[model samples]
Target: MQRRGLLLILSSPSGAGKSTLARRLMGWDPTIRFSVSATTRAPRPGEEDGREYYFRSRAQFEAMIADQQMLEHAEVFGNLYGSPRGPVEAAMAEGRDTLFDIDWQGGQQIRNSALGRDVVSVFVLPPSIAELDRRLRGRAQDSEEVIAGRMAKSRDEISHWAEYDYVLVNDDIDRSFKQLQTILEAERMRRDRQPALTDFVRGLNREFEQR
Candidate 1:
């Protein structure tokens, strides 16, 4: 018997440090593959094709949607982005876990799909609204207008916290990361995922009877 892979979905508001935890998680476990999405937007400087995204023309993307090739898709800022169904399915069959750093909408789509049972969703929240604002400002990459827009959107994002299986308030990075790791460890040990356990237990029973 073998084990099936899991789909780990992580969602958070703009400044809640979801990406940081995701990076640390991957660093902790190199076998987990990050789900690369396809976008209709052009690649930015130093961004390679098929690495950051599978950049496609709008027509190409629309065709994929019509052909039912996308696992999940949504329009953002007038641009289309979607996760490809092929690579993700391939990874799953190979027993390699996939990590999705997506919003609640994408997470919901994945969780409601044919492979829904394999999904383990987590939502990361900021310690407080003031701390979230401070984290956004501390980045120094956004203007006041952009920050305000993000803060507005954060309210909507935070409202979906109850949708996830696990919710972590990221008051400290180390503590949050440890909790995330623990979740992964426990999820991996679930009886359904470890199909080999059946055979292992059968062998144990046979050996004990012979003794």
Candidate 2:
């Protein structure tokens, strides 16, 4: 039986390396498709439209929310961001694995949708608070006050780790990525993942009965 794709949702606090691992997973596996989100936030200096994010107007975003076009919508850091339902549903129906890098609220929206069991959610965590702080400092992008704000948010984000099906500690990139790959591979092999497995098993039962 051909394996129907499973939804892989990876989320993490700031500097936990979920994005890095997700990128690696996509690069190594052609079957995995990314779920690009739409946002009302303006593109950063070199960010491109559609590729980095599907930049939309606030009105358009609100309209989608009104019409139930969005799987989930939330305001983060004063900017509106959300995952659209159409493309994600299309990919899953065609047996392509859709990867969603979303927060707990976004994931809840998916869970409430009809495609819930198709999901296999994982959350990534940093090794330690001090290590997370050091990594944030190393970036040299945020001011001390800004860093403090992010640190505060990080605690909030990490608090939701128990909500995910899988939790990974990203102490070492290579090791952590391997662990993620293992998780995907393991999920892929589950009996329920093969949409036709039931029919196949029933056919085997018929053959045995006839014999």
Candidate 3:
């Protein structure tokens, strides 16, 4: 049956393993397209322009927002980040599933848009608040000050867990990945997503009549 694609939205607090799980998912299925975001923030070291983000000047990004080119946009830490509506729609039209690593706010906006039905939101949670802090400290990529700031925001992020269709506690990466995969597989199997199923059922009916 011809199948339509899903817009998979994976969100979690800063220290959660959403990024790692996203990588594993893409590795599991190469056809899953990663939604590249547009950002007004300057690219970091070793980051490519279009590969990491579609880097834009503040003026350009604002222009896109004004023109309604962004599917979901938000400001964080004084930087503006958003997903472009055009590319996402194009990917959906081509039957390619797009994966988004966005926060709950962006998730809400996307799910409220015209393409809302195509979205499947998942929220990943840490096993515990203490464990969440531990994971953040383990990364060592951010300063202690930054970690503290993130910790303060963790509760806020976790509060919206129920908004997602699926909620996973990322206590163990392996198990979490398995659950994530199962969710995707099940969502893909939903009857509405398989547009060709109508024809297949009709064929079966005709064959039964001939018999």
TM for candidate 1 is: 0.93
What would you estimate as the lDDT of candidate 2?
A: 0.88
Give the Cα lDDT of each candidate.
0.93, 0.88, 0.92
lDDT of 2 by residue, 147-209 (tens): 999998889888889988999889999999999889988998898888798998899999999
Candidate 3 lDDT score at position 95:
74
Clashes of each: 0, 0, 0
List of clashing residue pairs for candidate 1: none
lDDT of 3 at 161: 95
What residue pairs are clashing in model 2? none
Weakest lDDT window of 10 consecutive positions for candidate 1: 1-10
Q: Encode model 3's per-residue lDDT on 1-211: one tens digit a residue.
A: 5588889999999879999999999999998999999999999999998889999999999999999999999998899999999888787777778999999899999999988999999999999999998888887878889887888888898999999999999899999999999999999999988988999999999999999
